[model samples]
Target: MNRFRFRIRFEDRVGMVRDVAEVVSGHGANILSLEVKPGEMHIQVDQVSPTVLENMLKRVQTIANVLEVTPVEWLPHELAQQRLRAILDTVEEGILVVDARGTVSLCNRKAAEILGLGHSLIGNSLKHLGFPREILTSLGVGRLSQQEILLSTPYGRLRCLVKSQPLVDEEGKPAGAMITFEKMSQVRRLVQSLTQPVMITFEEIIYASQKMAEVVALAKTVAKSDSTILIRGESGTGKELFARAIHMASPRRDNPFVVVNCAAIPDTLLESELFGYANGTFTGALKGGRQGLFEFAHQGTIFLDEIAEIPPYVQAKLLRVLQEGCVRRLGEMLENKVDVRVIAATNRNLEEMVAEGSFREDLFYRLNVIPLYLPPLRERKEDIPALAWHFIQKFNQRLGKNVRSLSEAALRRLYDYDWPGNVRELENVIERAMNLAQGERIEPENIILPEKNLASKSPSGLKRAMEEIERQAVIEALNQGGSVRKAAKILGVSHTTIINKMRRYRISGKTSGQWK
Candidate 1:
């Protein structure tokens, strides 16, 4: 028996669909399904010979006002399943389909690998396969959403981020369930690839200031050692850049150089991010667990940015790893020895934190083995012109403008400001001016400086004032455009830049113009 589906288009008239159905049935073909719409009818038939099908097609064409008739490649159900399989196969995540009784119906290759099911998975019961009872119960109740599952398979213990939803029948009754599995390690790798791309070297640290040059020279010297190095500086003083330069000059430069911002990740997640969990350590943990940034940076360097923001608990664990040269995954008894070089950078004063008992003194001493201080942009004013030109050339290529140089007046304005954000601020300012510059030379007006009164009010520190000004600018731009992309265009920056700034300032579309 052969199955076929076809679309027949005809003039709008009563009983035209009935006539097609009659023709199909008269040709000894069984009509499986028929859908009638304005001027068209889609029909699926089973148990039809090729000769009889051709005769039926000719008979249908003889009907009055019949415009076209074409056979489809697959039956409706077959086409839907084929499309679904194709989509599932293309995704990196694993996919599983189970019947209403919790028996596995289908599993994709990724699912098989992640679950250690080998090549055979179908017809197996979730409970018999060593799946958690909670998952089986959730599937029975049709309440399975996204949850982490730990599976003990022939291959090994696997941790998987699992999401399940019931498949509904025509009457909206649950017929089965479909679950997706994503390995946490794969997710971590993807995120790392997208966010951290270290390409900077020691030569890329453009500076004419003696203070910066001395700092770079010291950093180069220390790069030869595997000791823990702590870098101290004001925010935006190119701390991470210096860390990257150190990594590039080190003997382990060929390996991965992983950077983690302690302040960026929440306290609860930071521990797992640094020292990955073992299989079944927590709900929603990836199958077979994951390798944390420390493991990923094995035999290389792990730059802990904003090290002072690390919670006390994680600080203790980190100190242990530094002293013992090994890390134990959460919930695992065995410790894995790692040969990683640690480079920690923080804008905050660690000594003060240690005195206040906020930062562990032992960890502080451990990280500060060879402390490197990066002077603020205000203290290194001589580097302004060189850095400005460096950015001009950079933005010239990025923004596609031939900006030659900053005018003398523009240079004076840049030198006057106390660059509270340090090199990062200067880079942003120069990029902004390059985008707004009408001619080859950037003018003084193009260099947007903080208000004199606002800067004076924050004499103890200009960081807060500068942040407020930036927040206001982002809010105003967002208000004018009502979208991040449009606001980025109005502000003469990339869409991602605006987004990151919005996140930094905690600005949202709904909360525009309101400062916290």
Candidate 2:
């Protein structure tokens, strides 16, 4: 037996389809399916022999006003299914269409993958997939919006965002619904890729010095661990950047990467902001209370910048959260558990703060589990040219300018000057220069160094600036010669004078910083 489908064209007359059916029956062939229009018809028939099928085709054309008879690869319904399958497979999200009775009628490849099921899902009851019996109640029959749900599968708990649209017949009667499942994994990946500037990885940190490279390498190593990371650096040295990079590299990268500027929030409101507050705890509080950053960052990372500025009361609460993996809302006795990775950053010396009683000592120890020290831009001056050029390209997009590169004189000035504000300040300088530039190239006169940034990089302004230059010259001479006498020869000074200057400036191999 063989199944054959055909397209037949005939005149719009009474008994035309009857005439075609009689031809198929005369050949001892059973017509399995059929659809007809005014001048055309389509059908599928289970035939007994190829000779009979050929005879049926020839005999159908011989009928009155039957202009032509042709064979098609698929019946109308089968062809519609083939095209629907092709379209559903092209979509990324998992798709399923179930009948009103809750029997699965269609399932796509991605739906099977998301369910982690090996067998076909069609004809199976929704209850078999952990769906509630009352899920498609009369109220929800015609409309189902996107809602997150958890389904238990062979693999584990499957979390997905599901949306449903009801199908309807020509009479507007209820039909099966089309449901789409957006896997939580895909959602996490999309979040990590969003917010271009803030979602930084290790590659975004610009550097050309061995010291910065070593620091980055260490950061990469520690990022693999789940220990609380403490990033220590001077203000404007990009400690938050390092924190975000660490979170992106960690196992929780797909989850949240929340940041809280500890110094920015007031001392009084800081507790409620971090640990949340009960309803009516304060005049401006929300009615149902709120989820704190820890709760918000569950199964993810939370970066606390300027951690040292947190008050003593908040420090004790933070310590409890670190030790017990939970937080308590203000004005509420109940505590909520949270599984959050902490990555705290501080520019101030935490040890000194602990000793000075400004910050809690135990909390410091907990946060310092995996310490990372970000080197300042001045110590990594070898990267100034590259950093400057990077900023030039970045600003060209924003400022609508075609500044190509910096002049040699501009580059020399950048090298000679101290970057008081680190990488952020460098960006500002480049932006300012690009705005002031009259031509394609930025010249020395276009580079305007600020009088004082967050604070002066040098002490006593010009006097300290001169002393720093002198110190660098003396250090470079000694580094080349390895002795005071040789250094004095290079500096065109006596050995006694070289020794006196080193003592006065506290210059040594350790104090030379990255210059060594």
CA lDDT of every candidate: 0.82, 0.81
Residues 221-294 of candidate 2 have per-residue lDDT tens digits of 98998899999888788888888888889998878888899878877678988997765788987754665677
Error of 2 at 311 (Å): 9.7
lDDT of 1 by residue, 304-335 (tens): 99898786799999999999988888988877
Residue 383 in candidate 2 has what lDDT?
A: 88
Write down the RMSD of all candidates, one decimal each: 15.8, 15.7
| Model 2: lDDT to the true structure | 0.81
- In order, how many clashes per candidate? 8, 0
Instruction: Give the TM-scores of the predictions, in the order they appear.
Output: 0.54, 0.63
